[model samples]
Target: MSNNKIIDLGSSEDPLVLDCGKSIGPIKTAFTTYGELNETKSNAILVCHALTGDQYVASEHPITKKDGWWSLLIGPEKSIDTNKYFVICPNVIGGCMGSTGPNEINPKTGKEYGLDFPVVTIGDMVKAQKLLIDSFGIEKLFSVIGGSMGGMLVLEWLSKFPSYVFSAIPIATTTNHSAQNIALNELARQAIMADPEWKSGNYNIENTKPVKGLSVARMAAHISYLSEQSLHEKFGRNLQNKNKIEFSFDADFQVESYLRHQGFKFVDRFDANSYLYITRAMDYFDLKAENNGSLIEAFKNTNSHILCASFTSDWLYPTSENKVIIKAFNALGLNVSFVEIETDNGHDSFLLDEPEFFQTIKGFLDATYKKL
Candidate 1:
């Protein structure tokens, strides 16, 4: 039996409207829950997954048979202790793991949506998540937490439906995608599109996939998620299974081999079209532009306690980016905390076994729960 739960949301009467001026209905969302909802139903927490993450937050991933992505920080006695709080994690609408996306059959034509899938925005994603939360009758979430792209969703939740969130932690994320960020995403998209097998996103119909293009895209994107220090420490200039470079386009260095492994491994689980769509969404994310050119105005509706954390070596979304968020909260005089965790693990530090990060979240959540 699959470990996750699947729910069909939206209907003919109430279709999910996309930012692109399109509508879809009866969208399927795969999710998983941990712990139990208390009698008051106030201890519920929403955990948004990152771009490549699914609903397997604290359980085994059915595909890879690997431990949940955020297992390090969630469990019976972990930071977001399930014993004390109920956790709800749902696959985003544009996800491939049993969610409505390009890989799924379109009800209108009964074939894969492919390029025909409606473009989704961060706001659209948060809107879909709200439906799932409402399904559980959760009036206000005890906390909504995530890192990286997941963090962007948290910000969207705070901005669009402030009253529904009690507290939030947006880690290793920015208010908007920087120019460099957009450039990197474009590079990945081009890589996928350049593959001959892509066939304008109709590879599925041909019983083929642009695995080479997708793998290269994943490799390039994965590098941005790490710091130079971490890379040097982990692989450096070491040769890959050889005493010296006998290489002529082969993976001569360990770093190249490592990245190749990561890239190829990722292709086995992720969908190429999904990657294209999600990256485009990230590139289009801009809180300032969305809220009349004012980041503070974007969050003015929120009264929730917020904590923003960043890694010192995370050039992808540096501490400065995170501070912009804190500055907005500060301008609004909202209860907020900022932590620049000292780590060289880069943007992926939040996903690693960083004790300081763990303790910080644990303390903040404990304090927030007490206030509840």
Candidate 2:
């Protein structure tokens, strides 16, 4: 296993037509890898990150110096077992990380693309990932794994290239965004656009920032990512800042203070326009289209064994949503398994510390390790 934390693949500036009919760019995707691939090159596992997640899945964040989002699962001898499997994590296209996104400088405009960047879909992202895999000279993947938007990409990969992948594990995710999910995203988008400093998504390169609206949007979406129980456990009626209320229009609760910090930190590390684009892509995702207008048809040709897991409390992509996918696979007679881990982490369970989740993944991958 390599102790090095980061690997740069440089840039890939391939132009592409997004699902929205605009010709956008597929920018250079930076990725990180761990573990040593076997001679057969069959132990490679692609770990996809969720929305707002970057390529720092199992490594320290370059800017924050914080532990990687999935460090719990992807360490040398952890559940992901980097000592046994080569793991690859890439920053998705349209992301704010080193990957090309709305924040990238548009050669034509000589400025940040911002809203000018063309809209992209989940399929477009998977396609770019395929290119990256090819660059590594790997003929097939041992498994494709992810959660949230990353799970959406896993589904896309299975639908688009059923012949090449061996296994998939989609956690706390859905095939398509429900009306309720769409509404939540729309509200967040509205919050961002409502900001006067947004300046119609073309804010100049000045120190001026769009704080209020972005904070509100982050606050709202953050709530959706967490369950009520989680919020209560973390901040139950705790006072903010001072021991008692200031009796003024300010943060008076611990939750408010926490949200404010989250919102503020998010903007510093993420581009607002990229958030709008990525969330929109997720909102428009519809897997049925790939399966002859039915999800079962999509999995019909896949030989991959699936392990679909969800959190009992993940309302964002609840157990019911995971059942829909399992049912679709069963209808096609594909080998599939499902597990609904009970946790209060909500949609964010996959990223947090969950021993049961980690053990499940370890056992599943170990079951197929010999096949690789």
Candidate 3:
């Protein structure tokens, strides 16, 4: 294995053939691994990341220097228990991390892929991950775990390569993008495209960034990740710095200030074009359509044990969405478990400090490991 964490696939005859019928070659997958793979490689777990997430799953984020996004739930003695399982999280192809995304140079044009990069689907993302797993010489993953967009990838994995996955945990995600979800994504995309600095996705050439547009997009999307109850508890009508509300458009409320901070900070670490591509991929995701308009048919090939979880307050991907999946599993008589955790943290409850959520995951993985 190379000392550098970034795994270089190098120019090869077997380039990544995408779902769009286009091929991208010499792909590089940047990832991080925790713990060690057992001799049989039966203890390896693949951890898929959500939107705006990188492969730095359990390490300090190189850019922000903050703890890893899932540091709370993954470590030596954490819920997932890194000490027992080898965990690998790779930055998806459309991501801005070290992955080969729109920000990277195209071998043919010698410039960034920009808008020329083919739109990728969740299936494409899982295909890229499958290559990474093959490179590791792992025949079958002990378990695949993820939430939100990550959860979508988990579903894609189970559908595309049923035999390669032993178990799966898809948290707070649906098999297909809902109409409301597509509308929200369109709003965010319009925000980015509206900025003149975007320059038709060639923002890098002019040395100008679509910061304002991207910031607004992030702010808008951030609201959907939190529940009304949690937002109220955190910053309900509270003044930012003054006792009285300012008449100007300046941020007067604490909530406004908080959102502005999140928006601006996000721009510093994320790419506008990459954001567009990833969200477009999500909007195009419809497993039912891919499987002859039958959502249950998509999982017909998978015998992998599955644990589907959702939060009561997660309106974006509510318990109802998970129930839909559980019903499908029941129809197939597959070994599946469903849990609706009571939380006020909304769709992001999986990422928050919910003891019950952690316990549920720990318990499931532990039981699954014993069987393995």
TM-score of each: 0.99, 0.93, 0.98
Model 1: per-residue Cα lDDT over 1-372, one tens digit each: 346999988996799999999999988889999999999999999999988888999999887988999999999999999999999999988899988888999999999999999999888888899999999999999999999999999999999999999999999998899999999999999999999999999999988889999999999989999999999999889999999998499999999999999999998999999999888888889999988999989999999999999999999999999999999999999999989999989998988999999999999999999999
**Which one wins on TM-score?**
1
- Residue 85 lDDT in candidate 1: 95
Report, for every candidate in turn, its global Cα lDDT versus the true structure. Answer: 0.93, 0.83, 0.89
**Which predicted model would earn the best lDDT?**
1
TM-score of 1: 0.99
Candidate 1: C-alpha lDDT: 0.93
- RMSD (CA, Å), each prediction: 0.9, 2.6, 1.6
User: Is 1 or 2 the stronger prediction by TM-score?
Assistant: 1
Candidate 2 accuracy as lDDT:
0.83
